[model samples]
Target: MNSQKCYALLIEKPKTFEESERYCETIGGTLVSFSSENEFKILKGRHSKKKFWIGLKQVNEDWEWMDTTAIVYSQWKERNVTRDVFKDQKCMFVSGTGDWHRENCEKKLYFLCKFNRMRLT
Candidate 1:
């Protein structure tokens, strides 16, 4: 049997980043956060072929998880860096191809939430 403690739930319904965060709280979990490159890769592979939001988001000029953890690992896809400095909030998500992408918080998309198995079970 698997001995891991963390687990993920992929909410298939599309919702804005804020809405998704609230929903995860309702379920007693938070949007997924990665602790390492291997964890990110494994989770991304497990949920391949679909775009989904993770817990990472841009705060001013730095990206951080919803729980305020500094990002120690990342696998970002190459994209244009141009942005309107005053426009909207930027959120990050895992692409179907398993790389991180930054998007506006107002955009609707599926999201993954993480919960501790010890508390859940």
Candidate 2:
């Protein structure tokens, strides 16, 4: 009954961010990628305005989404001035429609993963 985008990446039940990331791998994908505005919109909200996970990370104080998709545009949320605020805090989650959430590399949450149907041979 949640009003969020349904994704095949996340397990049916809610899982931690670490668990979700690993789960995505099992399905031959990663915790989703949203480099385009359209893909970002697909994961706009939850029923109660909670944040979900995306496949991004911080390294050497730079914030980036999963390497799967090239970043077409960036619409950093108003409260996201803390990107790379921590040294080892890698991996990312995005919610709040256009904003991003960064957590520890091991933080857990339901994630949106994606995979190409076929290998690019």
Q: Which candidate leads the pack in lDDT?
A: 1
lDDT of each: 0.77, 0.59
lDDT by residue (tens digit), candidate 1, 1-121: 1244465655667998889899988888888888788888777777788898888877777677996767778787745533565336478888888988878898888898887577444
The candidate maximizing TM-score is 1
How would you encode candidate 2's per-residue C-alpha lDDT over 45-104 as one tens digit per residue? Answer: 432244567766654666655544565656555365453454455656665454664567
Candidate 2 deviant stretches above 4 angstroms:
1-16, 45-50, 78-85, 96-98, 118-121
Worst 10 residues of 1 by lDDT: 78-87
User: After superposition, which runs of candidate 1 have C-alpha atoms over 4 Å from their true positions?
Assistant: 1-4, 79-89, 119-121
Error of 1 at 48 (Å): 0.5
User: Candidate 1 — what's its lDDT?
Assistant: 0.77
Task: Assess candidate 2 and give its lDDT.
Answer: 0.59
